[model samples]
Target: MLGQKNPPVDRGQATAIIVFILGLGALLPWNFFVTASLYFKERLAVNVAVNMTLNMVVNGTHAGHTKDYNFDSWMAFLSMLPLLLFTLLNSFLYQWVRERVRVAFSMVAILLLFSLTAALVRVQMEPDTFFSITMATIWFINTFSAVLQGSLFGMVGLLPSRYSTLFMSGQGLAGIFAAVAMLISVLSNADGINAALGYFITPCVAMVAILACYTLLPHLEFARFYLNRDETDKQPIEKMPIKSRDKTVLKNSEDPKDPEAPVLQDYKLPEKHTHNQPRLSVFAVFKKIWVMAACITCIFGVTLAVFPVITVKVQTSYRGYTRWDKVFTCVCCFIMFNSMDLVGRSVPSLVQWPRKESRLFPVVVVSRVLFIPLLMMCNIPDSKLGTIFSHDFAFVVIMALFAFSNGYFASLCMAYAPQLVRSRDCETAGALMTFFLALGLSLGASISFLFGYLV
Candidate 1:
């Protein structure tokens, strides 16, 4: 009773926190960019400097003066470019680097640097240069961030399936948080520069938090239990008593009576390998889940091609809500899409709709491609295309479907892929899925450029 030692930290809760942080950090930048679309457009939209004065300076024509530059033209491509290219490259990059923690730290540093640079651009750069600079920063930041995302997904796949689910749900939270922030800023009529500064500052703080959580994970007792299991498996069975090894089996605090090691529910570690055997090829794993890969690719491709690029531009035809009208439309749509997407991602845990192996999965994926054209038809300014679903309420209905389908299908694809292959290759399968996810984003972003021109 003289001196008492401190209680041990809870590894289970710590691991959960880290997983949530990883998921949230991975998508925070994206949420901010999409949620803040209206703010960026207002500040960076092409100036109304139509010419004719002093040999084509300021314009006399009201029509010319009213026209704004098509600001969405370049950003649609830049936003998704890195996700596509770097995700493919990261497959090899991850293999080359043995220490994931180091890479995770590096990613945090890069995100912080980019966020700082974004703030600087707003302060130091001229208005004319804002669009180009902002686009370039987005491209660079996303390119590196994709690596971080791929790494996070791989790590999650290596853990229990619930961890992956937790990660995805965290992404939904990021969107909701962003939507709320933007809504507040717009309604409060917050200073444009101050609001933009908050946009950049928020992610930097999150990356720092993510880095801190990652640093704590390796040292936790519960985490070490899993790592120790991996170590015990590598030891020669002849040297280690089977009973002795069983004694070390990890037990969760919630299930103290259970003696089993905490391994992934869907995947089991392979039996001990003989010295003569070679390891499984990454392609071998990919071959098993090619259908899943295709499904995920098409899912993200269709989503990235249209989302903030096209959806954000779909203005409300309603005259009732005119004050901060663009901001209202953008924030409302973002919150609706994000909230529904969260529901979609979470649904797989309760029910896996359309079994992973079903032929209907691909059919479902291809059907989603129609959302792009359908969303495009909604109240896009200056487009020759006749508007049909012009009301904000109608657009809201379609967008909810669009976001829900994307989150549900993408989550299902990821969760099911690990189950398709051998247990050891689950990580590889997850990484490969991430590659396709990036590919889809890239493909969609590229298509968004064409849509931009047409609009």
Candidate 2:
């Protein structure tokens, strides 16, 4: 018995893996939407007359008076507004709808919306109609995804701190996966519409997996243990009626149930007493985390402003193999940012510098503003500002650093937030952080329009 091993908890990190996948599912739809920017542009750029002409033959030209559909501007405005509204609304909606119902319903809504999105790929409509429908669909999709995302973060916060990190890392992976999916979607078929038909289905598959993971999460021993502990943590110490104040304590006592796992004490409930930390008001929780929330908000805000909207327009003048020129945006910008972002998100698990409480953390986040101009000065075609970082290499390098910092600081803020508050307020803080992130996204997305114009 001297060296018997304890039974494993989260053996092989199965729970961790599930948590990661759940995180992946949480943001997969948004990633897919971001990655498929070109596809949407292609579909919406043409008028009904052009679309019909293309169907009769194989292709059409941009020669005629085309609809002035600014897809990027519309997309930026539509997607995040509902997302912002719904994310905040979820905190209140939790009163009427249970969290599980909200999550399950949100996933189902996204599935249906994407199904509609996929179905539209083959059918050509007037640019006006298509744009309207697309914008409405995006609004609804973000509406639901906001609920799912905010709720998932709150749920993950109830678990160990590491799970929160895993969850964030999973979202980072979602971006990477979407980027790869973009590559495949663009390359597999010459026809953009057909490629998108397949492209939209991937998230449907990811949704099934996400829903399954959510269902399986409650069944996991490790997840349940911490979840139960969180509930106990929330209960006021006074609520547990103390049978007696006199308590017997045992030290170094082995839980006979698990001989190798040492139990620090086998003790009775102490007399009811107030914990030193009081329950925080919602505003108080926000006050504790506002700095990080703002950091994360601004971080996302800045990233979105310059990313696909402007970065997608960046052209690399470096003479490449001719074929590489065609897919430059897909490779250099989308995939590059995402892969670097995933790397940045993962780094916190190893080295999270600029401790959350440090003055230096926000300073670093604020400094990322330079990226907006650095990216603007890249090889964007027809820019008010001419390209200085004209080569693909320069643009790629700037974007990599920009994206890495976005993931690194943002993850630190998210992971640090729940820790900075009372246990009962951890989930609340997580939800509030989700709202700020949306706030940042909404603001960044709006500003991105201006950035897009400046470029």
Candidate 3:
């Protein structure tokens, strides 16, 4: 009778919420780091005020983060390089470290870095020295953040696709959260040091709570059933063919200190195989999901090539008509895009058009490439062809479309990837998918400069 019982229900969508929180925590630290652009600019250019003006005057270049020792150069290149490097490296990290180690160690390390970041907020140092320490911190933060992201993606793949969608949606929400926090600080006019302290503190406190939520995750039978579903079928464990492997491996691997929490099952291999499932290599998993992988790569590659870099340049035509020019880029480019992107990611829960198996899925992903040219021809002054989309409404409409496409297609790619392979291969497929996603980021960033020249 017990063997025939259905899998436990995920009462109240508790598991989904945990996955969303973890996803939010994974990117929350980095979002804070990037959002404080003004504070970093002020810190990096503390003593170079006269020199900065003189340089801009002499060179006749725009006074922006490019010329200043701000985040543009250091963070754009240095931060992303390590993020790409370690994200690809983390694809193989499972061979050496346990899943819990990868997840826990990463969160703890990032939490410490967030603490260090908060402490450094009030400390005054020469800009060069401060920049050096800050760069080092950024590298380590990306390194660990990438690992946590891959681990969580792989774990989420064990469940259903909606969970993956929720996780990606959580990431979209993280960007909005960072933007709201930044807007608050900007509007408040708090001193840079105090504002930055507040920024760093938010992620640190949030991480602790998220970590506690993860610790409690395994104890829930709802989560346990999905996590080990392949093993815990309607059939009994004794009926499965146990060849040479020790049966003790099948014993409940719950944590001892907290005996109720089933922490180890997510990382455990089956004690024996029923059908002798072939162990799939990373490349094998990639092969099975290559279409989805390529679609996502192209989708994000096209997205990053234009967003912020090109979008920021497409300013309002009504420059002096109601102060819209001043806040146009901030509100239109960043806020509008993120807000709509959040909506796009969430919409999949209700309506996932272009089903994962349909040929139209890849077609839709490929079609996003057109947004690059559309955005390039917008109200950008530097465009030799001149602006085709002139009005503020035109720019806003295009940005909403662009942002929605990015969130929707990217979530679909993630949800579809792990399902392309067998049950045992889902985790590997998901990890490899993360690597390809990182690769797309690098590819798009590299080409962004080229696109800027075109505009």
Select the stronger candidate by lDDT from 1 and 2. Answer: 2
User: What lDDT tens digits, residue by residue, belong to model 2 across residues 169-247?
Assistant: 8998998888888778666756776678888888888888888888887888766655553345433311111243122
lDDT of each: 0.68, 0.77, 0.77
Per-residue alpha-carbon lDDT of candidate 1 for residues 1-455, written as tens digits (9 for 90 to 100): 11211113334578767777778878877677766666667764423331223224344333434334465555556767777787777666766774365356656656766576556635644445665667777777777677778777776765556667778877777888888787777677667777777766777777777778877777877544443323433432211222333222322212434444333232222445732234357788778989989999899889878877788777777657667485756465778888998888877777877987688888987899888889889988777676888777888889889998988888888877876754445556777888898788777777777776666
Better of 1 and 2 by TM-score: 2
lDDT, candidate 2, residue 228?
54
Clashes, model 3: 0
Each model's TM-score?
A: 0.79, 0.85, 0.85
Clashing pairs in 3: none
Residue 386 error, candidate 2, Å: 3.6
Q: Give one digit per residue, the lDDT tens place, for model 3 in 315-392.
A: 788877665666677788878888888778777877888987798888888888888888888988868767888888
Worst lDDT run of 10 residues, candidate 3, spans 233-242
